[model samples]
Target chain A: MDLFYLAISSTFVNNILLAQYLGHCPFLGVSKRIGTALGMAAAIIFVTILSAIFTWSTFTYVLRPYGLEFLQTLTFILIIASLVQLVEIILKKKSKALYNALGVYLALITTNCAVMGVALLITRKELGFIEMLVFAIASSVGYALALLLFAGHRERLQISAIPKSMQGTAIALVTAGIMSLAFIGFRGMAA
Target chain B: MSKTQHIGATLKAGLWQRIPPFRLVLGLCPSLAITTSAENGLGMGLALAFVVTLSNGIISSLRNVIPGKVRIASYIVIIATLVSIVEIVMKAFFFPLSEQLGIYIPLIVVNCIVLGRAEGFASKNPPLISMADGISIGVGYTLSLTLIGSIRELLGSGSWFGLRVFGESFEPLAFLILAPGAFITIGILLGLQNLFSRWRGEKFIQS
Candidate 1:
């Protein structure tokens, strides 16, 4: 029940993209197509879960023990970066289908702040291993959910004529504003 | 090349030509989250400047030793270290501001601007040039943040930096400081920038 609540809140109430503003770059940049968004979502889900566990355990065992909590930022980032690369290589060797699905996105996930944010949040919230894993999955799902909606909107936008001045990010951002407003309805469910 | 000209070019490029928010659209996650008020924006900007400047200088100095494959990791580590220092300093001195900025301080480790500069400018340039690039981009980011923050704060609070400008008759539109407000403000600013470019007969900045 605790893990379920955590997952639900992370997905809806405190969405990393709309509510928390963690991964705007990729959310905006890659959400132009449903195909790309789904791919990115799959890769992010994979990476976020693994790194959340990896960083949480490392923090609990090594950094916290040695009073090197200050190194959390440095160590966690390095871990995420390396982990993304490792996942790519291992996927390529083990499962061709999975690697092909996540190929480009696995590389792109290196700088995706949502992955790093998951690690940081897991530590900040002081969740147990199971809860942390659930939260990571939920956050990725939340991000993926938001991305799908935006990608659908952007896809529709391709056919609709927009003012030249508001063509690119301006229009996208305004849409994000509306999406943000919509997400606020989830606040009643907030913890 | 002349020293003065090189420094001037870096500053100009960073401040106006390739400003992070409007121009390059880098480091925007931080901008969106922290620009609730001018004060928070300024505080976050200062923390970013301190981190970006030091990290850029250090990365530039160590560029030669870092191998090709692991350079990105190294840059992030150096940036995270500097961000940690700034986090501690901010907590020690400006407790309230630190509280307001919250998780963003440590998240600076992944801020694209810091890593962007380290990889793009610092890794290739000398320490002096990289330091200059850092300061210039920092100033550009600070000005943009304060600008966005002030607009949101004015609309949301009917005051400038906590000073009431309207004589109590102002019922502030509360949405201006909310999550939507951040996007609205930046969106309007970006649109205006595009309109200005079109008016000036310049190439439209691609988002």
Candidate 2:
């Protein structure tokens, strides 16, 4: 029951994009096409989960035992960048379709702060290993949910007759604003 | 491009042409994350300015020595080192602000703006010119972030920098401070910017 609440709260109440705003760069940038949006969402989900696991292990076993918590940011970034590279290489060799779908988004995952934010939030919240995994999964799901919804809106936006000055990013941003306002409805749920 | 023109153009480009956050839209991570308040935004901007200028200078100075295949990795290492320095210094001197900004201060290492500048501008220019470019772009980013921060802060709190600007009548829109507020505020600001630029273009044509 507690785990269920955690999942729900993370998905909507404390949404990674709508609530915390951890990953707006990709949220706005890659949501133009549904295919690429889904691809990016999957990439973020994979990277966030793995990053949280690795960061939790490293923080608990390596950094804490040695009193090197200060190295958190640097070490996490190095790990994430290398991990993205490894994932890209493995996907390319093993699954051509997946590789083609993910394509440039795999490289982009390295810089997506949402992945790092999850790791940090998990540690800061002091979740155990299992709880950390749950949180990671939920956060990524939330990210994907927001990305796909935005992509849908953007697809329609491409055909709509928006004002000349509000075309492109300007209009997309305003639509995001409306989406964000809609997300506010989730705040009433029990966290 | 001619040498003199190249230097002059590069310096000018960072100010508006390649404005880090607004024009290039390269570094949205920090732009959205840390601009929750004017103070946080200023602190982040200053720290980023320092890192960008120093890293750009060093990268430009050592561009020839770095191997092409491994340049990105090398650049990350250098940036990580500088970010570590800023992180430590901030923690030591400005504990309160440091605590408020949280993991974001160190996360600056991964900020695409700094890396983007290194790869796009710094790597190609001389040290002095690259440093100027870095500073100009940094200023542009700082200006944009501060602008966003002030707008959010003012609307969210009915105060500018915590001084109540609007009297008791103003019931600060709670959405401006919330997560959705960031998107709405930035979106409107972007739209207004586009509108102004178009208006300016029309004026130039008429004149």
Candidate 3:
């Protein structure tokens, strides 16, 4: 029940993208098409889970013991950057189609603040190992939900008569703002 | 390209031509998130400027030795190292500001603006020119963030930087402080920028 609540709240109420506003770059950039949005979401999920596990272990095992907790940011980023590279290589050799689809998105995920945000949130929230895993999965799912929904809206927006200046990024941003307002409805439910 | 002209152009490009957030749109994460207040925006911008300048200088100097295949990974390591220095110094000295900034202080490592400039501009240029580009772009980004924060803060709180610029009768728009307001404000700003540019072009042609 606790894990279920965590997952639900993280997915909607405290959504990483909408509420916390962790990964807006990819949320806006990649959400133009459902296919690309889904691909980026998958990549985010994969990298978030992997990076969380790695960061958790590194923080608990190495940094804490040596009183080098200050190095958490630097260490986690380096780990994430290299880990993405390793994932890219392994994916290329193991599965061509999967690699081709997720290939470009993987590189971008290296700097996707959501990935680092999860690591920081896990520590800040003081969650256990299981909770950390659940949070990572839920956050990624939340990101996917927002991305797919925005992509659907944007597809309709392609035809809608928007103002001359508000056509591309401006309209998309307004749509996101409305979507964020709608997500506010999820608030207080967790309480 | 003429070397002298190229150097001069690259130096000025960071201001408007190659603006980090508006033009390249590379570093919107920190640009939008930390700009809720002018002070926070300045703090974040300065921290980023320091990081970008140092990393660009180092990366440019070491560009020859870093292999092409591992360049991105190498750049991350270099940037993460510099970000650590900033994080430690901030925590040790300015504890309150560091706490307020929260994870964002450390999250600077993954800010694509810094890494993007390093990889795109610094690696191919001389150290002096790369440093200039980094600082100029950093200033441009800082100015943009400060502007966003001031606009949001003023409308959201009926105050500028917490000074209560508006009179007691003023009612602040609660939405501006919320997530939606950030999006709307930036979106409108971008649209206005485009509109102005288009209008200017037409005027120039008419004359």
Against the true structure, what is each candidate's TM-score? 0.96, 0.93, 0.94
**Candidate 1 docking band:** medium
The lDDT for every candidate, in the order shown, is 0.87, 0.84, 0.84
Best by DockQ: 1
In the range B1-207, model 2's lDDT, one tens digit per residue, is 887787778767766566656667777767777787887888888899999999999999999999998888889888988999999999899999899888788778878889988998889888988888888888888888888889888888887766888989889887787777777777677667667768777331100
Q: What pairs collide in candidate 1?
A: none
Worst 10 residues of 2 chain A by lDDT: A164-173
Record all residue pairs in model 3 with backbone atoms less than 3 Å apart, i.e. clashing: none
The TM-score of candidate 2 is: 0.93
Worst 10 residues of 2 chain B by lDDT: B198-207
Q: Tens-digit lDDT track for model 1 on A22-124?
A: 8888888888889988898888888888999899999999999999987888788888888988888888899999899776888878788888888887888
Q: Tell me each candidate's i-RMS in Å.
A: 1.2, 4.0, 4.0
- Tell me the deviation in Å of residue B117 in model 1: 1.6
- What candidate 2 gets wrong by more than 4 Å, as runs, is B1-9, B202-207
Q: Candidate 2's C-alpha lDDT?
A: 0.84
The list of candidate 3 runs beyond 4 A from truth reads B1-8, B202-207
DockQ of every candidate: 0.74, 0.54, 0.59
**lDDT over C-alpha atoms for residue A57 of model 1:** 93
For model 1, residues B65-151, the per-residue Cα lDDT tens digits are 999998887787788778888988888999999989988888888888888889889999999989999998998899999999999
